[model samples]
Target: MTILLFGITKDIVGQPTLSLSHSEAQGLHTAGELKEFLKDNYPDMKKLSSLAVAVNSEYAQDEHAIKEEDEIAIIPPVSGG
Candidate 1:
């Protein structure tokens, strides 16, 4: 699984994208699972109230399934002029 973070999300993760190998993405199967994985992996993100995820260039709902080859991105809310 590959994950990308944009805007402030990149700042949080310290990178624009992460290439998660099969072994690295273990036990992950859905968008919800991905969120849980991130929450467990990075304690900082655990406190966030909300976030958005996209799978394969499209918005992902909780019910959206994830695949090993899917390209996922984590999006954070922003306010800028």
Candidate 2:
């Protein structure tokens, strides 16, 4: 699976996207689990004020199941004036 990163997430991850294998995301069946996986891999992610998970271009709830081929993105908070 590939996860797109935006804003601060991109900065922290040092890349626009991340590629992970099914084994890397093992046991991550839901959006919530995905968050935990990310936090575990990237501790800096937990410092973000907020992070939203999007699947297939739509905001996903914690219960949203993550499929191997689904498009996932980490949308961090944006601030502008």
Candidate 3:
């Protein structure tokens, strides 16, 4: 699975895109699992005030199911004065 990163999320991950191997992709069954994986791999991601996940281009809740063929995106919190 390929995960697109946006805003601070891209900066936190230090990449615009993240690719999961077929085996890894199969291991992640839900958006929440994906988030945990990211946090484990990239601890900085856990520092964000809030994280939003988009699956198949639509915002997904933790319970949202995910699949290897699905499109995913990570969106971090934003703040402006």
Candidate 4:
């Protein structure tokens, strides 16, 4: 599974994308699980107030199921004046 990062998420991750081998993605059945996995690996991600997970280019709730072939993205909070 590959997760695209945007905005501050990219900065925190220090990369534009995170690639997970099939074995690494095996237990991540839901969006929430994926989020937790990210936080565990990249603790800095936990500092963000909010995070959005997109699956197949669509916003996904915690319950949203994810597949190894699905496209996922991490979108951090945005603020503008």
* Model 4 misplaced regions, further than 4 Å: none
TM-score of model 3 relative to the true fold? 0.93
Ranking by TM-score: 4, 3, 2, 1
Colliding pairs, model 2? none
What TM-score does structure 1 among the candidates reach? 0.88
Q: What's the lDDT for candidate 1?
A: 0.83
Best by TM-score: 4
Candidate that beats the other on TM-score, 1 or 2, i.e. the better one: 2
Expressed as tens digits, the lDDT of each residue in 1-81 for candidate 3 is: 999999887988888999999998888999999999999999988887689999988999999999999999998877866
Task: Note each model's CA RMSD in angstroms.
Answer: 1.3, 1.1, 1.1, 1.0
lDDT of 4: 0.93
1-81 per-residue lDDT for model 4 (tens digits): 999999888988899999999899998999999999999998998888789999998999999999999999999878876
Model 3 Cα displacement at 77 (Å)?
1.7
* Deviation from native of the Cα of residue 45 in model 1, angstroms: 1.1
lDDT of each residue in 1-81, candidate 2, tens digit only: 899999988988899999998797666899989998888889998887678999999999889999888999999879887
Residue 7's lDDT in candidate 3:
88
True lDDT of residue 78, candidate 3: 77
Q: What value does the lDDT take at residue 31 in candidate 2?
A: 94
